[model samples]
Target: MGLKSVLSKVFAARVNRELNYLRKNAIALQQKTFTDLVDAAKDTAFGKAHNFAQINNYQDFKANVPVHDYEDLRPYIDRVVKGEENVLWPGKPKYLAKTSGTTSGVKYIPISKESMPQHIKAARNALLSYIHETGNADFVDGKMIFLQGSPVLAEKNGVSTGRLSGIVAHHVPAYLQKNRLPSYATNCIEDWEQKVDAIVEETHNQDMRLISGIPPWCQMYFDRLSAKAGGKKIKDIFPNFKLYVHGGVNYEPYRTRMEDSIGFGIDSIETYPASEGFIAFQDSQKEKGLLLLVDSGIFYEFIPSEEYFNEKPTRINLKDVELEKNYALIMNTSAGLWGYSLGDTIKFISKDPYKIVVTGRIKHYISAFGEHVIGEEVEHALMSVAKQEGIDVVEFTVAPQVNPPAGQLPYHEWFVEFGTPPANLQAFAIKVDKALQTKNIYYFDLIEGNILQPLIIQSLQKDAFINYMRSEGKLGGQNKVPRLANDRKIADGLKGYIS
Candidate 1:
């Protein structure tokens, strides 16, 4: 083998060895907590995992730890908010990560001292892997710009409490942190509107080499920057930018638009970050999927997607999990989320259990009119139609609206917002219908002489939907227009423009 191949093999072997050692250690360390909880639940007979009383072995553990959603943890969260110890873990949490969902309002998620290391470790490993994969460790000889939240701590009752991103930024390595870039603390901390101009001004002549954040916000920043620079590209603003890192949701929809807005083909990496913890990250290659930080401060359980919707869900241990299978993630973290379900679905793409791809959100499924449609199916259908019709969508959300008709099944009404609208809207819609029908037989059956009709396209004015979201007090942050809604509530909310 050549020297490069041999070196690659050596590095892979080291990573594998470290992963194995960590996994083995974690099993023993984590079991202490798991066993104690199992005993306590058995004793209480009313706790969440009380059903696991019958479990004598790992099989019992799998069967008994009932699958739970965020709603199920409301009481625990309340306790945490009230400063209760051991709500999910053993001590007072260091901070609370703020997150929200379609059903849940702003959630204050607890993060313990132990879990902080895991988050940091996962982020570091991902960065190192990226460096190794791209052989670009030296690319950031210049300042690294983190397009993140502000470092200004929120004041409550005259005391300083910080946002999650602020706290994380405070801990970033001093050497790696940008000295020239705008302070997220001063510039991007307040209302997004106030932050946008500062972001534009700060980045105008900076030597930013790395940019990281959610895609939509990054897009907005670049758009504003381009406009301020008299239509100059992102490369013109920061001529040395070498890498872009983004997470929270899929970046596929905004990838092309972002590239165009930036006017350069920089390396891109995606991360799977959550309020609970930094779970996984795309390695350097960006093609091998994300590596799960198994040794980091979290213990993971995988529930097969097939069994996800079942009333009683079964969880598989990481030691025995397989690749290419859809699994609902269960996390037991130092942050105190034992057997807690994060409501995300992922599939392993590599033999290493760490390498995974986030498929979709578990609650983001639609079954209106008895035709069950999932995120993967919808994304696939959209991509297929885009390829067939030569349309490029900047972003889109699908909601199943019921149109009940006499002697007919209910059909889906798609609300699509495209960057490149097709010349023949009807043809594009028909192509989408065909794509869905081909992928899902149920969709085909629903369409054949039934109530379901062709997919409808509503080409929105550029930034129209974004403006709407901003008006709703939901823009400029982690919030993106949700992809799929089970019912017509969100869809109806977006009416008037649906043509």
Candidate 2:
């Protein structure tokens, strides 16, 4: 066998064995993970304050450590930034991943030496697992272009900090460094537009095989490459391209445009990596769920999405989860974050190896009319409507029209940027409205009671979301517009640029 074929088989065999072990010993693995985390942090300031040494099981851990979001952990994080050792974890963190939410404000999250390897390993394994399952290793023989954020890092209080993608980019295996696209100088350009132009000039003729990026940015890269090649499809330029690994946003809405850009359907792998930790990734091509990393140095807890906003919420671990329940995920990481809210909601699709799909963000939902619509429901409604109407959704978002122009019942306002407009515009709106009514009972009742009017469909200018994000200084790299908002924030903002 050729070297590529031989290495592919070896990796496939090793990943299969690892997957089997995780599946077989899931419970034991999870319990041991909890035990190890508690043991390691028992004497740190956070652990000591919470009496971590006395914690012996999931019950004890939950009872002592309260669930927290970034704001909740700010005090400890502030201390960590001030060069405090053993503030949250056992020692000082070497790096911090800076992130911001839709509402605005920066969150500096610790990346301890203990936790860095977990992120790296999860990313590497995500690609390897895909290769193992699909027997597609020839792609690795060529270059894989990771459209990453800048690799240049900044420091604060003797600790380095930058975008998670940037930090991860710097640590890519030296062997792949020879084949990874976007020169280090291009990655350091700092301006998104300038970088894209530089990237286009640099990669137009390279023999690329795999592409990884968040969908919108990937869409932008593909568009630039195609434009430079004079309307040629990405496949025409790089025939060897095979895999498209993406995350940071739902890939469904962007699928059609992406396929059109590449001129073909390429295999894709999804992951759920956050600043807190590398969470999960698509593991089986036969299955639809992402395999949760059981022993990946992070302990997990789940709060039912319905009860998460309630006064008293039920917290469960690996041993107590059920399939098909909406959950707000919480993590106690290899870093010293105890019960930190990742802000994302997810649903379990499989349990043997603990597989899940990200449902939405805890705050990224619309219940404006008591409809309690979640991100998963919005995605399903849009996809269903688009499929039936035979149109392609480029991007979309919704907000409650709490106050309309009078004589009209308040309802949802949907801003859609379509790749291909439907022949009958009313049919598109009807389908979108009808699909939501079927999925959400409160929405159905509001429509039936005539308390809410038919949903408004406002066509958005092509690149509206990209422009809006650019205005907010979040044009590229891990930024996304919330598909559903509880109020007029996202909707009003987009209305300013409607087509």
Q: What C-alpha lDDT do the candidate models reach, one value each? A: 0.69, 0.86
* Cα lDDT for residue 339, candidate 2: 92
Worst 10 residues of 1 by lDDT: 40-49
Candidate 1, clashing residue pairs?
A: 88-336, 130-284, 150-184, 151-185
For 162-182, candidate 1 gives per-residue lDDT tens digits of 556666766676655644367
The per-residue C-alpha lDDT of model 1 at residue 69 equals: 66
Which candidate's lDDT is highest? 2
- Over 316-352, each residue of candidate 2 has an lDDT whose tens digit, in order, gives 8878889999999999888888899888999898887
Q: At residue 206, give the lDDT of candidate 1.
A: 73
